[model samples]
Target: MNRKTLVLPAVVGLLAPVLAACGGSDSGSSGGDAIVVGTTDTFTQLKTRPAPLDPAYAYDVGTWNVLRQTVQTLMAYPKGDGAPQPDAAQSCGFTDSGNERYACTLRKDLKFSDGTPVTADDVKFSMERALTIKDPEGVFALLSTIDTIETKGDRQVIFHLKTADATFPFKLSTPVAGILNPKDYEKDKLREGFSIDASGPYTLKAEVKDKSMVKAVFTKNPNYKGLLDVKNDKVELESFPSADAMGEALSKGDIDVMARAMTPDQIDKLSAKTNGDINLVEMPGLEIRYLGFNTEADSVKNKAVRQAMAQVINRGQLVSEVYGTQAEPLYSMVAATVTGHSNAFLNKYGDPSVSKAKTRLTEAGITTPVKLTMHYTTDHYGAATKKEFEVLQKQLNASGLFDVSIKGYRWQEDDYKTKEQKGQFDVYGMGWFPDFPDADNYISPFLDKDNTLNTPYVSNKIRNQLLPQSRREADRLSAAKDLTEIQDIVAEDVPLLPLWQGKQYIAARDDITGSEWAINSSSTLQLWELGRGVKG
Candidate 1:
C-alpha cells in the first residue's frame, strides 16, 4: 500500500541523546555499527526460514518486514514519503491511455547478491510464479488485472491489463512484485534450501533455524545498488513471546529497538521518563480493529439486533479510556486517511445511547436480555486486547439489553476449528493492516462470498458489479464515489462494526540513528536504516 508523508525528522522527543547531532554529519562515515530490534508480532515459519523470504509465497507483516529489506521490486516506497520510486528499474510508469499498459526499464548492470545479472526474464519468471503458485495468502488477487506480460529487450518489460487500473503502479511497489532469481526457484514450487539471492540493501547472514526462525541476523548486501544509504553494518531481529517480554528487553538494554506489539501501558511508561533514553516514532497508521457479526447465527440474525449492537458501542470511551492516545475510534471500515471514507456509523448511531439501543431491539421483537457470545484471540493481537474486550463486555451489559459471554482462542487454532461454531459466531474480533492502500482492499476481502470472516455474506452488487466498476475507473477520487456507496451499504446492513484505527508506535533506544526512517508503507520496520548515534 502507498502511504502518507512521514514526519520523523531528527527531532528530539523522549530520546534526545541519539538524534541531537544529526544536523550536519555524514550518515555513512561511521562503520561496524549494529543494533538489535525486538518484535512481538507472530510470524508464520516454513521450513526453518521466515516464510515470507520468498516473494512469491509469503504474506503477513512479519514476513513483509524481512522481505522489504532483502528483496528489490520494480518500484518501491521512498523513505521521506511513501510515494513510489524506481527500485530495480531505471524508470517505470503507465504507457497507455486505458490506464492498463505499464512498462519498466531495468537498471543497467543490476546483479543479485551472488553477482548474477538481473534480467527482464527474471522479472517475468517472478510474476509468473506468484500467479501460477496461487498461494492463498499471496498477491495473486492483487494483480488480477494483468492480462499479459511482454519483454521487449534485455532491459524493458511491459504489462498489459484486462481493465483500467490506476493503482497498478502502487501494486508494483509491493513485496509481491519483487523480482526473483530464476535459477533458484521453480515455476510452481516455493524455493527450499534456506538459500537466498538478495537484490536489496541487506542479505541474510546465516541459515535460519529449520521450521522456526524467531531470531535472525543480516548484513549489508555488497551487490546492492539502490537508493537507500546503508548506515549499519549488521542488524539482528529478535522475536519475543509477548509484548511485556519485548518491552523488558528494551528497558534492560538487551534490545536496541522494539518494533510491533508494544502495549499502551508500555508506551505510557516509556513516554513518562524524563531521561533521554527511549524514542517513540509515532507512525501514521491505517490498521483497523473491528468486530464481525455472523448473520447466520440465530442470536444476531435479525438486522435490528446487529444495528442495535452497533448503536450502543461507545467509540470515544474505547479509544480514550482503553487505548489512550494510541488509537482513534473508527466510524468506517475505510480508515480516515483514505479517500471515500465517511463517519457512517456516527451519522446513524450518534453517541451510543442505551435507550436508542433498547428501542432498536424492541422494534425487531427482541427482549431486553438478548444473548450474545463474543470471540477474540487471546495472544495474537497484544496484551491490551483482553482489556479492550473486557471493556466492550462491560459497556454492552451495562445497557441491561444484553447477556454477553466472551470467549478466547489461540489465533492459529481459531480459524481451522471454526466449524465447531457452525461456520459462524455471534460476534468475533479481527484486526486488519492494509495489503494495498486502496479502499477496495478493506472491503472486498471481508464481504465477498468466501470472505475471511467465514460468514455467508453474499453481496452480488458489491462483488460482481460495484467493485468491478470502481476498479475500472481511471481516477481514484472519482472511483471513491462508488466506494462511498459501498460503505453506506455496509453500515446499513451492519455485518461489521468499526471499533478503532490504531497508531503505529516504535520504541527504540536513544542511541539509534536513522530509526526515524525505519517504518515503511507496509507498517514494517526497515532494520538496515538503524545505526549507532554519534555520542557527545
Candidate 2:
C-alpha cells in the first residue's frame, strides 16, 4: 500500500525536466516570527455555510489553497518531489485486479483540530457526502466513479468503483479527498464560517480585512500528525485586487512573499531587480494556454481549415514575442514535463507555412478569405493574453489564407457563456491549471463526450473506450502509451489547439529561506516549508 518509493520517484522522474531549476536555497533570511504572503483575490472566502470544512463544496484555487493547509488527505504530495505518501491513511491500494476496489487503513491516533478522532468512518462520510451533495462544479464529479463505500471497523475503509479506474490515487491526493470532521459538517450543504476544525499542518487563527484585501492568519497545528516539518509559527496570506498591487506591496516591503497572479511583465521586472530587495524562484509549469475551436460553428467545420490554421500559427513566435521565457510553445495537450507527452502537432505541421495552409484550403474545396473570428476573455487571462491573441490574428491574416477578426468578452461571460451564446467566435482562447499532475487530467477534461471545453466533441474511441482502458492500468508508465495515442487523436481531430505551457515563478524578499521549495507540481505552495529570515 505504501507505494511512495516506487510510484512517486517515477512521477518525479517524469517531471524532472520541469524541476531542473526548482531545487536549492532559501531567499536570504530575516529573523521574524511572521511572514506575509500576497496573492490575487483568489483566497477571499473561507467557505460558501451548512457543510463546514467540506472539500466537496469548495472548488476555486483560493479555497483549495486554504483547504489544503487545514485538512489532511489519504495521500499527499511531499515537500519537493516524491510520490504521494500516506498522510491521513497509513497505507492504501486496490484490493482487486481491475483497479476497481480501493482500500485504506487509517493512521493511528489521527485527530481533528478540535480533538475528535479522525477514523475510517469519517473518511467514508467525507467522500460519500461529497458525492451525495453532487455540486456540479465541486469534487463530486471527480469522485463519480465510486459506486459504493464501506468502513470495516475503525481503521479500514473500502471504495467500490463502478468501473476500473487507475488514476483513483491521484484523486485521493487532491483537495476533494480532504477528510472532514464528521461532527462539524452536514452531509449535504455548504458550511459558512471562518472556523478551522480540520487537521493539516496549519490552524486558522483569524481573518482580517483591509480595504479590498483579506488577510488570513495561521499558526502551526498541534493536532497535525503528518511527516512535514512546520518551519514557521505564523503564516499570513494577504489577497489583493490586482497583480500590480501585489507586486508593489512586495517592493515596498509590505509583504514577505508574493506567489500567484503576477503578470509575465511583472515577473520580468522583478527578475531584473533581484538583489537584496527580492528573489525569484522559477518553478516548473503544469499550466497550459491554448486555442479551442467550436467545431459546431460553420466557419471552422472544415477539417482542412482547422489544419491550415494550425500550419500558419507560430508558437515559437508567440513565446518569444509575447511570453518571453515565462512560457514555451506546446505541441501536445499533454505537457512536456509529464509522462507520455508527444509533439504530434509540431510533427504534422512543422513551422509556420503559408503555402501549406493555402494548399489545405484548396484541397478541401473551401473558398479564399475563409473569414474567421477569434474570441478571448480580455479580463480573465493576464495582460499578455490580448497581445498573444492579437499576434495570432496577425499571423493567420498575414498567411492570406483567411481573414481573421478578433472579439473580446468579460471573464464572467466568456467562462459561463455556452457555445450558442458565443457562436459569433469560431475559435476562442482557453487555459487550464491542472486538478492533478497526471496527463489524463489534461486530455479527459477536454476530449470526452461531456468534456469541460463546452464544445461538442464526442470521440467514441477516446471517451467511450481508450481513456477508460488507460485508467485501468495501475502502472502510470504502462498507461503512458495509451495517453500518447489519445494526444495524437486530439491532434488529428483538432477540437482544441495546444498553444503554450507556462513557467511558475515566486518572488520573495531576499531574506526569506524556504521560498525556493514552496512551489510544486500541484501549482500550490507548501507554506509549512517557509520560515523567517535573520534580518527583518
Q: Write the per-residue lDDT of candidate 2 for residues 27-143, one digit (tens) a residue.
A: 433236688898773332322223323487655455677778887899887776566778888899989989999999988998888788888888988888887877645356668
Where model 2 places Cα greater than 4 Å from the true spot, the runs are 1-32, 41-54, 192-197, 205-213, 378-381, 407-426
- In order, candidate lDDTs are 0.74, 0.74
TM-score of each: 0.88, 0.87
Q: For model 2, what is the alpha-carbon lDDT of residue 188?
A: 81
Per-model RMSD to reference? 4.7, 4.8
Model 2 lowest lDDT segment of ten = 1-10
Query: Which residue pairs show backbone clashes in model 1?
Result: 48-210, 48-211
Total clashes in model 1, counting residue pairs 3 or more apart in sequence or in different chains: 2
Q: Backbone clashes in each candidate structure, one number apiece?
A: 2, 20
Residue-wise C-alpha lDDT for candidate 1, range 1-536, written one tens digit per residue: 11224532211112111222112122433365458889875544433333446777555577677787788888876664444778899998888777888999999999898899999988988888888876655356666678899998889999998877777777887777888888877888877534456588888754345344667677788888866677787888887889989988897989988988888998777656555566766665778989888788888889888888898899889888889887889999987777667788888888899999899898889986888888887776788888889889989999899999888876543442243234556788878877666777788768754444556666788878778778776666778778888888888889889999887777777667666667643476767667786531
